[model samples]
Target chain A: MRYTRLSRKKRSIFGSVQLWLGDDHLLVVRSMRFTEEYRRFHLRDIQAITATEQPQLIWMEVALFAISALAFLMMLEVEAIAARIFFGVVGAALASTAVYDLVRGQRCRCRLLTEVSSEVLDPITRVSDFDRLTTQLEPAIAAVQGVLTVDAASMPVFAQPAPGTPPLRQEDRVETPAGKYIPLLLYFAILANAIAYAAGLLGRFNEGFGAAASFWFTEVILCVLLAFQPRRFGLKGPMLGFFYVTAALIAIDGIVTIALIVDLMQRIAEAGRSGTKTPTIWNIEWMMTAGKIAIAGRSLLGVVGLLALWLGRDRVVPASEEVPPSQPQP
Target chain B: MTGDLRCDSCQGGIPPELWNQQQGALCPYCGKRSWTRVFPAIQHTVAGQSPEAIGSESESSCFFHPRSRAIVACDSCGRFICGLCDLDTGSTGGHICPTCFTSPKAPGSGTLLDKRRVLYDSILLGLNLGGFFFFFWPSLITAPLSIVLAIWYWRKPRSIVPRYTTFRFVLVIVLGLLQTAIWIALFWSVANSPGRGSRGPAL
Candidate 1:
């Protein structure tokens, strides 16, 4: 059978997802750097398609891109010509992404449901894509399975429970405490480190270093608390692993910072004895390669952490809400 | 049927009354706008059935489940399977036993259980490119490996999506040859350099 491209490829940092229309089925291919996974739904088997508006998420992306672009623009004030050019290019790139996201218009979360499974059409992030997919799929599916009429409602596909069955109630559902705030807090702490590191690069070493040190201390406590009760925070798999990794990195950061501080103290003592001018702590030359590496690592982790959290946020649920056991989630 | 449709944001059931409305309905739980299009298949429901017991001594029983009466024979192995053990390959029109369905090597299993395919072209390309740029020294080993992989899987299917061109395989071969040639020339130049023996003796 022949397959034709149905939708434009939607890309993220890690991988991409695309849809293809086959002669008899619709294929969703998720392509990573090394491999591709395929999920096919027969045209006759599709039960329904739902497109939900996601204005808040689209606005979040716009704000994130705009704010990040502005933050990078701050580097233009740095004295180094190389630094200014590098940050300028980065800022321009971020600004362009923001514009692209805005021009794409509103986004939606579209899912295709069958009797056996429900699959998200990730490539149909834009509302336009959803409309196009539905337009294309509707006729093809209708040709195979025919159309549903208003009179069909009397059929009642779902069978009622036997007499005196207890209906699922709000109190019957499992009440999970809101674990959403912990991850948000972790994100804040990591972001603060990233900002502090940038400030240090711009001649505010003492303040930046102090701020980073304080945040790491706070992060250590937060990570430990979250690690102890991961289910409470609605974290599993990679999100849970992130907290463990953060704890390890915090320890490594502490060791590296303390070593740098001790070396700085020794240099100050030597300068006092020799009666020479004391070197400024803000001097990049004075900082060892290891110190520079540690700060940069922290900054990179912070950015990656933010993206990962945002992409996987759907799995997390608020504590105030209870999810019923009887109803299966799509 | 209402329970079948759910709000994406809140995971709450969407009311059946709003199933095919022109204007999207506000989700009762989260108050988000959601549009739904239901098809005729939504009304197609499968009724559950329990396997029957063996009525007589002469009656055929399920191969794996001996106590239960045989309902259908496996399309692959011809073994009788009860209702509980029969795995229907929907649309493919076959009733496969659990053992036959799970084993990819089983005859006719590919039609029922093909899920993933490895792209040899992509792997060959990554090995050649990543080795050459990131770790120059490792290319000595990887270059030859990429050459072998490219030639070995030249006719093998790369992607199920039908990538018509063999461009990646060709590129991998060319890159591998170039990288291997560079390493060989470097080794030759170093070994045959002037004063190479004399310098070593003086040391």
Candidate 2:
């Protein structure tokens, strides 16, 4: 209950944040230029302190393994010494990257009995620093709790507040990280739409406007969805307003494209029946079998991408992550 | 439930009868000058639900625990889940399995389900600053996006945390308008240059 400040120290955060260690509570205060925020947790509430190492070599390991596999597979064609040595070098590098990944890149987290967990301190990249930091914090927390102390008659410790002391921060709403890759999938769909459009342009849409309209229509849809992502995540209000506007735009484009496709197909049918098709029409990629194939492939990718977003809808966690797992029921 | 309160200093439980004593009466347990108060009564109610156990081959089993009974199916993936596997979807009003809830692509995408988000205000401010510090013609995209984002999300919810403020929204608009004005002036000057359009085509 004591609001008197004992000691204050600057901690690692986005801005000038301070850690105020008081008689019985640890208060963390942070603020941007205009806004300020703080959270207070009772000393006795913390349950566990964990130091986790997260290495940054998972991507490199995967890339190197693929290269190693490719090199090893090539050994069947060329039995030369260079091929064998190349495979050995890649294979070694991949193994070493995997080892480094396992051995390095760790972060620390503090678990509290109040159903919340957070990385109180900055991430520790080194093993020695990790150990030292945890040692410093564990004892400090125990000292404040009045239960565990280094000395039996330690300097008449801080007053032991009651067990039911209320914490300032009861809960934090964190967004899940479920459909994070949706943007990438939507981008791929956009790329597919671009290729389809290019094919339609090559097909000379003056004769068959349907092909060009459909491809461009699909492209517009991808753009709308991409723009809608931010609002879908957490950006609400006017961001949502633009989202609906974008949806309307895509819908209008869809309807127009459908009409164009129908008209273009009708023209093509009429041209074939009358044997009046332009000679250049045959050379157009959008009109050819290959163009249709590309269009089909891109459509499939777009569908799959949308499916991924739909499935991973509930997986977004807030940007400021640290919520720990809830305790299991007895 | 006993109508008693625990001492703030020593955590000694004091019964309701103790409230009739002096304002700063000495507690017999800790000998601390404690102040006893009568708090509003609380009615505690405990309810229970029996989770169905995984039975024969015909019955569904919990996804997390194979032996536990499948009481509720995950609303997201429709996978049969046990009571232990059921986690509250916060404000989403449903129960989901740990796997689907934690996954970044399982479709539980909402404000409650999101782990982190690209703060629109931050992006808007950054764009405004970028445009202001270097408001060249090439910052057309950044300037427009800054203005749009600032105006659009002006009244939107900022962060899930209640401590933040959206004062940056004004800064973004101010900076963005300044940058846009500079670009407009530059374009106007270029357009009115005596030689630009005049020299384009003598043909």
Candidate 3:
């Protein structure tokens, strides 16, 4: 039987391949460069042989991706009404499953290929005529090479590996840097909830639609960003951007929430002083005050979001270093 | 031999049936002996080196000659640097080591410190705003103080520091505005509510 072994160099550009012709004899091939032309193997020269199945992760990945898409679509209707509640549930589930599937797939691929390859191949040799055929084919198998290229400028400058170190192998994996987006999403959620609650309290829920729309729109955009590429705007980058935009919106929204809260408080205060039930939202006095507070709260969150972004400036990796490695696990 | 045979790879003792599994005696460490070769164990030692007391070793070594020891560690690379490689900056105390403390690569201390400080400032701003909402007017002082501190911090030579200082300043301003709005809303509600012939009808 023939066995072909391929091993990559730690620093050199090209990989090494060794072909064992039989129990005692072997053939060694070396090349300064790798080329597709070397991959062909002639089956006519082979007497008999067993084949090794290459490890693949297509099925598991497809299943998880399908599941995540399904979960996203399921929440679409509810998202139109109360997006925070709807997306919160959907996001939590999809993120969790995606994370789980990614981790499991990585472990399975690494272990089965590196540790169990020899054991699985051992049984294939038992077939008659397989050994002789494989021996002749071994040389061709050794020529195959794996190539990976990395853009160094995209990664954090602090963690850049010394030149000549192999580009990180795990770069192809998907990483969700949801930290920055979560806070921005949370800010919008809280602002929306606050506005809704205050508007309801003041009996002006209908008029509160503007603030609601703003809050919901911002929330949706943030959720979409998170779902699509969490790592691209990870850590502090998206948070700062979200805060600036949301802060502006909050500045507008806060006016409404604050107006309502104050009007309610004043009505209660006045009733205490003069001893009379406050007239409802219809009254110009109460309505106007509620309007002011609503606008204020809207404006407040917006500004607060901005401020959060500013104070969190260090959080945003500089643009030069903004492009994170394609994949950063954990 | 009279003893039981073993495989080197698996570390399992071999049975009589598999005694001649390959050409040679099995390794006791791992049971499998096929495709394995015996080699003498080698010990690595640094020649002409003497063991020194643990704390006595110098922190820095010469830049051109890494082995020549010096007292100070390079502020940048954390390498032991000797006198020839040490570049002295008077106020900062230790001389910067040439290898690790190159000017282009080394980040300024102020930049790192400012980033850390901004995080603290954000927390303070948030808390102060909360206080203002809860009717503690004195807590609003942080708003103005934060603005001043931010401006002062940012005014320094532009380094990585201003990014965080600006962030903190923005946070304080946002908090301040929110607190002011809350107060305004309170005033508006009190002013507009119906009264008992004092201002208007009680609502």
Best by DockQ: 1
What DockQ results do all the predictions give, each relative to the true complex? 0.19, 0.01, 0.01
- Please state the interface RMSD for every predicted structure, separated by commas: 6.9, 19.9, 27.3
Candidate 2, superposed: residue stretches over 4 Å from native = A1-13, A16-330, B1-53, B56-59, B63-67, B88-94, B108-110, B135-141, B148-158, B162-174, B190-203
| TM-score, first chain, each model | 0.42, 0.28, 0.27
- Tell me the lDDT of candidate 1: 0.70
* Position A160, candidate 3: lDDT: 22
Residue A329 CA displacement from its true place in model 2, Å:
27
For model 3, what is the alpha-carbon lDDT of residue A207?
A: 40
TM-score of chain B of each: 0.72, 0.52, 0.32
**What C-alpha lDDT values do all the predictions have?**
0.70, 0.47, 0.40
Query: Quality of candidate 3's docking, in CAPRI categories?
Result: incorrect
Between candidates 1 and 2, name the one with more favorable TM-score.
Answer: 1
Off by over 4 Å in 3: A1-96, A99-330, B1-121, B128-168, B188-203
Error of 2 at A250 (Å): 77
| Residues A228-273, model 2: lDDT tens digits | 4554333254434543453554465467446645756777787788
lDDT for B102 in candidate 3 is: 39
**What ranking of all candidate models by TM-score puts the best one first?**
1, 2, 3
Compute the lDDT of residue A126 as modeled in candidate 1. 67
lDDT of 1 by residue, A1-330 (tens): 456788988898877888987767788888885677878788877889998877534455445444544445455346788887776677557655644554454467999988888888888886667778888888888888898874424546432322333334443333222335556666677778767766775556655765565566556655766667676556778877886787788778778778777878888898899998886565536464565676677777777777777787663223343323322222
Residue B127's lDDT within candidate 2 is 67
Lowest-scoring 10 consecutive residues by lDDT in candidate 1 chain A?
Answer: A321-330
